[model samples]
Target: MGNINKDNLLYMAKYSAFNPYRMREREMGYTTSIGSSDALAKSLYCGMKAIATWDSDREKAPPTGGIFNLEFSPEGTLLVAACEKKSIQIFDPLTHERIHAVNGAHTDCVNCVKFLDARMFATCSDDTTIALWDVRNLKKKIRTLLGHSKWVKNIEFSVKDKLLVTSGLDGSIYTWDINSYTEYNLVYQRVFHTSSLMRCRLSPDARQMVLCTTGGLIVIIHDLNLATLAQDLHGFKPNLYRLMQMSHQMIPVAAMYDHLFDSKNRENRVEFVSDFPEGNDAEVVSALQVHPQGWSALSRNISHDDKSEWTCIHDIQPMESPCDKDTRDTSPVGRGRRTPSRRTRPRVYRVPRPMHPNPMATTHIQITRESERAAAGPSTSHQGGAPISPPQPSRLGLPGIQNDVWEAAITIKQHRLLQEMYNRGADVPSTSGYTPHQESPYTSDEEPAAKHFIRQNKNRLLYYIEETNEGKGFIKELCYSSDGRIVCSPFGRGMRLLALNSDCGELSGVAQDLSQPRLMVELGQSLGIHTDLVVSSKFSPRYHMLVTGCLEGKIVWYQPFSGESL
Candidate 1:
């Protein structure tokens, strides 16, 4: 038994390309690289349970027809399993007590299992159908989904839990409104290709769905509410009556831009004005503005579209360069790609534009600097030619010009405030130099050393990186409690738990190992210094206590706190 944070393990997979050493260790099946400590064991070892992964030598010389799919329920109590044994088994997760068994549920092998709710569960099989069952009344069958003409490969419930989608060997995806069990009454179904749909998922909001096909094409489907379409089409439904009938039309845009800005300004002299608009050079708007006086707008003096016959539209003076930070400038709140849905969350994004060239080279500012005003200039004189008192300069450095003048929309004060924050380490880049740190999971390295890439906040290291791996695999399943008191590393192969050593800001060294540590799915909750998790064997979602599931289709339930294998 060894203890280690699951994040560290997933980190290894994420940065495997960059950090060859750590990845090599992972490939060599090195579990518990962080070393074992008693404190970690006591904290993480809530109970014992069965677990499983793909047989290491599945396609090798010695082929063992064993278990493949393994999962635990949302409550982490019961484990549900589909194994090569062609049977589903139930047992005490901690004590390994054999509770019940369903021998030969399918002609071939069981593929996967999912909990519909707390009491109902669903299982798919190589037999090409999904069977819904009432787990509490195991002898009865709730329903059987039979749309797939071939073996069903996967199934998932919608976010709202009203719809269930399934894909399989037939290269088609089918969605069913569970409440309306009619076969032809399918809500949505599409034949993607001759190849199978390997996986699919509904978005968190249930507005859209995505599909990953074996043919390598990612298909996106837009679902429309019939009521909304009816209202827009005929106006029969009033007061939001047509929302349920509306259809979404996808339109392609050639270009898009976003800009975000803080309302506060600290710089007095220099400021940001506006962004350039889209168009040919002939009609391109070179300047933009946020000012009321129109002093920040830029109008080109000459049109460059006709090289032979140049025309001046307008011109102005130039100043220092502007600040550039991608996070504050370009990126949205969530990393997800945005769509044109009005219901989507509103965000502030900055539209980027090129800075002006040196206005010193221009004759406008050059003339003012060397004009007679540079010498005697003009004095405050009355009609009698008698010198009068000159008023103090305006707080803003706007010069008095007879014709017109262009100034930054951002005041000098705003620019100065941003600079102050930059100098004070308010927003700093993680890496200082040109080193290409691991910013992506697909990069050829494990996560970069925490010191080089992560932001340290007192006792915690926080960062988010993307992964190229398919559906919530090894690293994707892990999550931490807000207080950092518990760690759940639910890998596709297995799950691990670790205790947070609050005093040392390090992980304790004790751990518990199941048969297939890689197949365990983990989740945790914290009450105090203790965070509890339930591990189950196979696909059993029901757990009265500490339950476990094995990839071989076995499950167990026990009382981990009392050390009783019930």
Candidate 2:
């Protein structure tokens, strides 16, 4: 089996454009080419292109409402979309064919859709409910979760803990255990935010969360691990009131920023380190997306006009750089770049010592004599020989050895006097000695006061889109590929892809020509589906495929790398 896997890997390296080993080598600064042809070709492989489009039947008066969300199965086999109407559609990504459509899934518009596993998925609706459905049996819904009193805006599932977290417009957040498919039990609830909750997302490690509100507030809650909470607090249950009280002392350290209301008080406000020029008018941040690598993209309304939306991407400088070494040998000489030297034959030698007498042996001798006396019959004299006095103390009575060759050495008479005083438990005669508080004989200069340095944040903005569609269309969603190579967004009537640029440390278009700043895959223009706007887009987990949905009720599949329809 191991040999077979190795053979498969070798075959992929030889035939496929995606080369994992080559990418790693380039990242480590070991590549010999400085912008060579091969390097450019490898970079092109990371770029994206549109391939196919699947449009809804226009004559059927298809739901004119736009798609609100798009999600793909864990295996990338099926794609699902939540439409503005009370409907949920599933399509085969490989064939670009609609396999299932559930009409009247909810009483109101479906807002978000997410796949729990390969065979099960969940959708949230404006009807204040969440419905779970099995892909095999789309006609029959699996379960309905009821807790939020208002429109459910967002839902997220933690695969590690099998818990689903949902937020609603009623200013409440709830957590449900999905381990039992038949019964969805609410595990946690909180109503800490005063305004309506717009969205909630768990961090990549599931240790923190980022939440956005309709009032333009962004809140980050740290240390949100359920296991950590259960272990630290005794008899703790998932209740809103208890969690709110415990939040005052323990987990869920929160940081909030209300850019819209607090812009005038910049000095006292918690400002994110950004380089983008702040608009004269305050912008209401509506959505936030954070990448696993600490980068973030925020969508906001920069103007008074309702449709004047903007998206900005920021790069957070990591506390530690990737080049930091964990070992003492940071020199690259013996690293993978060079071969290690062979070990030579061992050589034997005799050990040499005697820098000073062992103090431990001297103490042991004294102990042995005392023990022998105790074991022997009571006698005034020593057991081994004549009565022996304790070793005489020198005039220079320090803790360790005294310098015998120096003129400061004590004479024999002085040593006898000191030994007698010690035996009698009397203080010895005073002598001159060095003290830390005393002035030095060599110099009179005073030491300098300690100095402290403050470090400033270096976070900067990588890219900004002020008017993606002439201030007409709003950004619906933002997604980063699983490999972190590309970031996609549904701007207007199409989708845009941004590739990471190594030179400028920003996301730029794939086209070399920069005259046109907007380089997007125009779905409407390419597919001739110009009736409505494209609203939702998502990337596959394991492939280069992308699925996009439009307001005209069309689900289009595209091969981003090859421009070849599947």
lDDT of each: 0.33, 0.48
Residue 257 lDDT (model 2): 18
lDDT of candidate 1?
Answer: 0.33
Task: Put down candidate 1 lDDT per residue, 1-566, tens digits, no spaces.
Answer: 13466654554444332334654766888774343222233333444332322222332322212333444555654555564445554433444444555666666566666676766777777566677776687764576555554446567676554767676544445555667544332233332322223444444344434443211123233342222322222211110111100111110110010111111221111112111111112211111111111111112111122221111111111222244232121322112333212223322211112223233222111112111111121221112222222223233322122101111112223434544444343553445643233243322322122111111001001111111221111102232322233343322234344333321122212112211111112223222111112112222223323323333222223222433222
On the 0 to 100 scale, the lDDT of residue 423 in model 2 is 41
lDDT of 2 by residue, 186-263 (tens): 334342332324567766656555665333334444445644332232221112111112122111211111221132
Name the top TM-score candidate. Answer: 2
Off by over 4 Å in 1: 1-42, 45-65, 71-78, 91-96, 159-161, 169-171, 183-188, 191-196, 202-566
* TM-score, cand. 2: 0.55
Give the number of colliding residue pairs in candidate 2.
0
Model 1 compared with the native: what TM-score?
A: 0.35
Task: Report the Cα lDDT for residue 306, model 1.
Answer: 22
